[model samples]
Target: MSLKVVVVSWGQLTNVVREVQSQLSGEAQIELVEGLFDQQTTLEMARQIEASGQVDVFVSGGGNARMLRHNLQTPVVAVTVSGYDMLKTILQSRTGDETVYFVHFSEIIHELNDLKEVLPFPVNQVALKTPAEGEAFFNELSRQEQPVVIVGASLAWDLARRHGLKAVYVYTPKAVLEALERAVELARVRRQEMEKTQRVQAILDFACDGIIACDQQGIITAFNPAAEMITGISSQGATGRPVGEVVPSLKLEAVISSDRGLFNQLERIKDKEVMVNKVPVIVRGEPRGAVATLHDIVTIQKAEHQIRLKARREGLEAKTTFAEIVGESQIIQQTIAQARQYARSEATILIMGETGTGKELFAQAIHNASQRQGQPFVAINCAAVPENLLESELFGYEEGAFTGARKSGKLGLFELAHGGTMFLDEIGDISQAIQIKLLRFLQQKEIMRVGGQYTIPVDVRVIAATNRDLLAAVREGTFRADLYYRLNVLPLHLPPLRERKEDIPVLLRDMLFKANRALARYAPVIAREILLHLPAYSWPGNVRELQNIAERIMALALTANLSEHQVQELIGMVLQQGAYEETVKIKAGDLSLRAGERKDDLKKEIGNLEKEVILEALRQTRGNKTRAAALLGVSRSTLWRKLREDIS
Candidate 1:
């Protein structure tokens, strides 16, 4: 009943705008806004319209409507020439039993074809791009003694009419009447049905509580926005999939057996305690779908904590500082120096490192070191949120941005990061459209909300991080080149754990001490042999893997009184398993071997095995030939000579 509508037209088309507005007078509140003068200003006009904040549905005539719709989130209803309008014009024409040529824009030919199928008279179609083209075509039609029906929306239609050709504008009387009737019927039906449906859907969507609806057969029929927000799975992908497949803890059978509503709290989903309300959606005394609403108990508490923190931050409470960072390695020192230098200048900083290498730690350190440190430090993972929701997460949205959007609306990360730093993690994973918007924000220091207007100026520093090679991504066309250049103003690369071998002992001692304190146990002495092996093994998972291994060792020492020898035994078992798997693969013919050879093959195989062993020893020693030669139990010169002979 309270639908807001905007009528976009040229100032000269006031009469036409009033006619259309009158039709929806009872159903919606209509506001008229003049759109762009030409196609080139379409995006700017759309932005202007959105900034006014007085429109919901953008009803536009002319070619600019298409361009406007492409730029804005508002539903655009473009008025086009309809089948009935063409038929009416043809029937009223004086020329009869003559070949009628319909001169129109090429894009409207499809609509003309549909009309041809229904009309009784035979008609010929010709596409004209401009008024001059239409006039030339009409002149040829006149020479052939054929009647012409010109259908277009620009000066082409006007010129065709002046040339005595039967011309109908895109929004002709017949087309306008048909469109108005359809709009009226649609508005009435939508108004009546949407009230109930929207209220229920709003509860399912906007509430922090997650709601999932399943049919009698336990097939998920509806996965609401809240459900998606909680599970990190999209509603579209979750629909029709089994409930158990979407969320393992739902236990659909329990609800079916009860045949009544049930309220409970479960701790299995996402390792969080969530309160749930499950009820059967019975229609005509038969259960159609079961609805379950759930809310994370911990998240509610966190929300309260965040509110207090925000208040405290605004009240000049001391915030996290550079002193809070606890690392002393040369790599860390160099990274900190770069962060400090870049903190004063507000250029975009790209922080690149492997996962768990503390890219976020460095980002936070940069924010804390900057002038905007006292404000919010908003961080978002581009890879974590689904593509559809990420727009709202970054730019936010107005109330009712979409079917499941919140009634009160939502604020985005950019808004939250105002006056501070917005750290976009895994920046390479963002979609092209989002990348463009982000690029614009970086260029202009302003953002337009997902379903909003009036670009809000944000005094924010951008810190982006990704483990991906952005230059490679640019070549692959996955990341935008312009956005990359914009963010790459200052680049800081954190060395992987294996490359900084000197830092291993320091990290180990710190992690061990932390683990011992947490476990309430004495720190087990790390044998010199174990410390040597640690640096030699590649830490693919980086610092996180090292921390986990340290914790595991500490747990073993505390619970089973495991010694350093036991740790070595565990490592040996893993290596043996890998060797066994490789041997199995070779025997299974998974690896190709050269055919039609006999004794030469055995000699080749022995040579290959010796080469592999030598290469592995050299790799473990980091290409130190002397250590490799010692491990091979061969003289240094003999090993060198053998390696040279193999190369030859």
Candidate 2:
């Protein structure tokens, strides 16, 4: 891209343009115009040159340069008079008593003064503050009696020559080269600025977010394509109009007045809900204007929903089904049939069963059989999380809702299970406050997030499960009656292992196969004699407990055998461990204390009872941490940590 340069000069100084052309880098193309020195005429000629084509820069001398700079859109570079030019002109002139007059612009008077000390002759200097002042000074000099010799700018020298006086033009080739160099640099900077503006405009047009910028007076200066779509106002109409008139909902004037930023403020523009963030554009500590970015609220919500759906398709899904429920007992079959029927309905279901009785399994099976089986099957244990954190775990929260919150917030289990089933395990263990919130969601099908102000509608089918007697909890005032009734709309009572002992053999065989695969063991069979004794014994921990015991027995032997002693010893160990745990429970619940027993004494007694149970389990397992942890339904780390705390 060649820089287009226009030079305005006198006919005598036409050689200056040739010299500038020689000094120019090949990046510039120069055109010269001579004898047009008047301000009005120079401005017209500059405009004509621009209209002819592109004019990146303009170069001229003194008065013509100043006029072109003020009147032309293209940048104008003025040829400056150097101190050396003034010194040379003074040295060639007349001496003292024969006065030499120097008429120049006021800004260059300091350069002329520096040359005064070097001159052997005294000279008179006249300073022209304005173009008008210079013209008047020239007229006064033309009427003088004595003929004067003058050295100054082109305009002053031309006026002196018209009045029949001798005049010397103070133009140097070095000054013209400097002006041309400056003009080239100015053109480069302007070109870069224009390119940057074009890039920013392209980004604003392509962005999904609507963008708008306003001057300090609230007149809209910019409106992007998205802004037009969101606000229903075209850029042609919005720009140059007051922002308040274009989009009255946005309080841009208020933002400018306060010199502050507002984020994620919901407003209605043209009947569309938008979340807008308005910020004052500050420059050098002063509020210059303001800018706003808007997002359609509905669009944002849909995008969030799509993200969750994609995540669900990638990993979160239910693997359980009715076929996975391994049981042949009448009660188990009846329970499965009732669950299948409930799966056809969208009502909330309450599954009542003891811990480890496969309540979650039933919930998953129900989801897998339902119409929304292909969607997410999210679950959360209400009892596992602390009360303070449970609400966020269930309903999620907005960004910056609390300390250490995720910057973009998080989706809760309920939100993740949209259009599907959400299994709220240990539902009865939730706090009364959370119960009220849950009941509200059950009734309204809407939930407000933790530390949020708006309600979000969810289409999730809730299935709550708990071992606690919700009716008893409701009667005791510990649980909300409304919530209990809401959850108990479809009640399911799962029979305990003791009541369904006929399913033990089948359950044990299936558990053994799974344990074999998981533990990398070759145990593929259990003795019939061992299976016969399992039905007579009460399986306190239900199917899960029976599965654990199957693993224990398989650890003893892999082949089928009729060994009553081995089965008897394993059963005795389990029964003894159950007895010890039962003693701790009974003692801990014992309200009637002996006379003179302090509360501290009762706590100590309970702690000692628990320690004794743990010790007996350790003894039965022969100090094996894994076996002892499984026997107590706890982890090995928990057992070790408990021992450390208790021993200390």
- Each candidate structure's TM-score, on Cα atoms with residue i matched to residue i, is 0.40, 0.46
Per-residue accuracy of model 1 over 313-370 as CA lDDT, tens digit each: 4533224455654466887778778778988878899999876577887788788787
Candidate No. with top lDDT: 2
Output the TM-score of candidate 2: 0.46
The sequence of per-residue lDDT tens digits that candidate 2 reaches over residues 1-648 is: 777777788754567668656877758777788746456776776788878767788888766777777787778888887677667776675543456888865454666777787777777788676657767777787788766678876667777787677787777677778888888888888878878999999998999999999988999988999998888889998899999887888978778866579998989888999999999988888888899999998789889878865774466678889998988899999999999999999999999987567999999999999999898888877876889999998899989999999876877778888888888988877888998899899999998898799999999999999877889989999899989889999999998877876676677767766756432222222334444433244443567666666666656554544355555665556545445335434443443352136665866765665587688778888999888867765545446646875988
Show model 2 residue runs off by greater than 4 Å. 1-309, 312-314, 517-536, 554-629, 633-648
Local error of candidate 2 at residue 417 (angstroms): 1.2
Best by TM-score: 2
- Candidate 2 shows a clash count of 0
Task: Look at candidate 1 and tell me the lDDT of residue 26.
Answer: 58
